[model samples]
Target: MHGPDRDGELWRRSRVAVSPDGDVVGAISVLRNPSHSGRFSVSLEVRPDHRRQGIGTALIEVARGLRPEPLPLSAKAHTTDLAAMALLQAVGGRIYQQCPGRRPDPTSPEIRSWAGIQAVPSGVRLDPLNGVTADALAVAWVAQYLWSHEAWSPVTSPDTLAQRLREGLADLDPATSTGAWIGDELVATSLVLREPDGAVTLVAETIRRDQPDGVRLVAAALARCMTLLGDAAVTNVLIDGHESDLHLAPVLATLPPTPAEPLLLVEIP
Candidate 1:
């Protein structure tokens, strides 16, 4: 095992297992979880030929030995990856949350179903963001983000969280971003982002969960955003969100069910 190095307010380190021939067979990295203090996130990978050889367990033990806090360490495994899940569970890991990913077809009938809802419940109106910057919607983003992740991540710093949200928002494609508004208050935002890899993601969220029409309104806004994306000649928008999100789940479910590499967040105590 190697020594940890400082990274921001946390420490990160990687350890590897090598065979007598000096070929690396397995490797693991441990880093502090930014969202939850005192907890570490680990990633492990072992060569295919090295299965059931205890290399994975040995790497985890190395991570456990370098615990920076009392909380249990965390890792993510795809729900379908039984072996990885079992390995972590064998070492006392438990699934705490799920983050599902999908590439929603913009032309799907379900998505098109929302196109007719120009004004959900007949009052909420949709408007394009034009060139609005993310900082302009700080409050709504913070509320929506925190609420979506509340199950496993608690707010650590309001300012820091807001800053992080804005950073992500920086990639916001205003031309395709839409806001659902009731009069002057912006209740929901459907964002389209083009990542550094050129892959696009659609993230629609509502700060009006307290309102009866919040979810529907956001759904309509998402459709409106997609329509604009189509107009701009952009295709292949991906979406990944908390599986249990009231605002995200139903909208994602509108698409046909397909095999997806959904991840389960696991924690080992």
Candidate 2:
């Protein structure tokens, strides 16, 4: 291990890697996303100078040893990081999702045209995060719980899920977090958080597959978030769409996002 384990509030956990000579070389983090259930979303990184030294691999092994069992691990890599991809494959990771990269300008006319297509699915109405009541949130959580099973993830405690929502709405600001509802049932939701650098990022955007509104909820949330980011020139839009989410893959594929590498995922066997 490179340093002491970092255990943060709200169930976030991480471990670091150290070189044989006592130098910190890399690290790995696992977000036990309550929505994803059993699988942990993993990120592995090694210092550039430590390339090909097995540091990344070692870090993964360490992380796996420390995480929950029967829960397969997942990590993302870009095409530019050939070494990382190779290392992941050498250790049995396979690409599961293709994450889209950012474009130079999110405000471009072409992308601006996408908003219409991503608008609210039929029969669904959008509501601000602040207006959502506990009962409604429970409906969203239940929808997520059912979705998690299909995605092969474990459904976390309702309290944990609610806490996750609070952190998101607070971190992203309720003005930017919005949900989709049909009558009283929460069917879809999307929340965006703005980086200090001024670029906005998508935090949560989901709609129940069974709902007629489909994935259009993301469009409504996105349009609202972009409006919330008024005056900020949004040249970049970052989306992390893993392969596990089949619904998101097509959206990324159809768009001409900025010239950047797509995300690749590997699953530990």
Candidate 3:
């Protein structure tokens, strides 16, 4: 596993060990969303058979020396997975947040109705994914950061923001990333990403947390994503909520969303 693969700006992932045959035995990843600095996160993986062998600890050693001033790190692990959970705790991990994974049964009448917002909020409109431009997306990022309540870095200048937007756009599946608009300003954003398992996850960002129609705008974004899904059934949706976000948890709770997994943040000492 060869990488520290410089992903987009401010991100890199590294593989610390590989077997003689070249299979990945262990790896470590570093991610600092310009939006989340002290809250930066890292992920570590070791072949199951290789655990109890101290690889996780060694990798932590490498991660502790990470560049850009050694900010705190976070990672998610399943709640019931004892080994994974224990390994993280061994390294001082704790539950900073818990985002339940929900599989929204697309056939449910409730969800079906959300596909097209019955009543879009006043003076605001949901824009098609195609309607989003780079500048608007950058603005959306700023909004997400502001509304997010996570203490991460704010985009500082036009050039830096533009570059970050370009990098983000390259990773977005435009058909799935939709926006909310007030006149020309992009006020909110949502993305439904299709994972390799064929499950689509719903994530949303609204600039104004208190907007009267904030919740509906998110629903509209998911609705548009459902349109892109076409006939393929969406059997899984993972809703990740930060401790401070006001809407996601409550809205998803209405789906009576079940607790599918417990997301744990492993604190790197």
Candidate 4:
């Protein structure tokens, strides 16, 4: 066993377990979340051959002992992973949110049907997020994100969001990323992202809670986003939604249902 070594710059600590033969078997890491001060996000993995042993429990104990104060740990796992959920449960972890993960066909008729639909609420204009300053884009994203009613949504500030956008801008599909505006005010956005794993995703939301046509604006942006999927050469696009999502959920429901799994975010307090 080794480490709970601190990386001060990143505000993280990690531990690793190695077998007597010098083979690494498992590892765990805890990172401080920028949005939630003092709280930590945890990631753990154990080699299959080392499973059923006490390694996982021992690691959790070590994680708790890293600091004198109690550690509030947050972790994400698929509900299909029975063993992982069991371990989380053993450590007093409770489900904080349930995120629905779906992989809908990008070439579906429903998607194609929205290709030519330009009907949006009166006075609203649809446009791609090209040439938009990161600061401006982040402000718009944060506004909608806060009012999204998504259980798994994290609290974010404009600075953090801007930095994130700058870092991931290379993967952002500008041609397919659409925004809704009433004159100069951005009301909604649907961003298409190409993941490092080669998967694509469409994230759409309404930014203004008070805007009566918020949902319509989001739907229109998403519709435009779907229509441009072909231009991006995307065959599969994943979307994450919360059951209680105020606007995004309703827009997703209009599409044909696809196979989805429940992704759980667990917290240990």
- RMSDs, each prediction? 2.8, 4.6, 4.8, 3.2
Candidate 1 deviation (Cα RMSD): 2.8
Q: Candidate 1 clash total?
A: 0
The 10-residue segment of model 1 with minimum total lDDT is 110-119
Q: Rank by lDDT, descending?
A: 1, 4, 3, 2
TM-score of each: 0.87, 0.68, 0.69, 0.85
Best candidate according to lDDT: 1
lDDT (10s digit) by residue, model 4, range 1-269: 12455554346778888999999898988776655534577888899999989899888777777643475887888989999999999889988777778766667775677545636899988899886777677677666666663345455444654566567656777767998888888888888888888878777887776777766787888878777785555667777566667777777677667667778888877
TM-score of 2: 0.68
Tens-digit lDDT string for candidate 2 (15-42): 7777679987888876665545466667
The whole-model lDDT of each prediction reads 0.75, 0.61, 0.64, 0.74
Relative to the unseen true structure, what is the C-alpha lDDT of residue 243 in candidate 3, on a scale of 0 to 100? Answer: 39
**Model 3 spans with C-alpha error above 4 angstroms:** 1-35, 39-41, 65-70, 113-119, 122-124, 152-165, 170-178, 181-186, 193-199, 220-243, 258-262
True-structure lDDT of candidate 4: 0.74
Full-model lDDT, candidate 1: 0.75
- What clash pairs does model 2 have? 37-153, 37-154, 38-153, 38-154, 94-266, 97-243, 103-258
In model 4, which runs have C-alpha deviations exceeding 4 angstroms? 1-4, 7-9, 20-22, 67-71, 114-119, 146-158, 231-233
Candidate 1 stretches greater than 4 Å from native = 1-4, 108-110, 117-119, 232-235
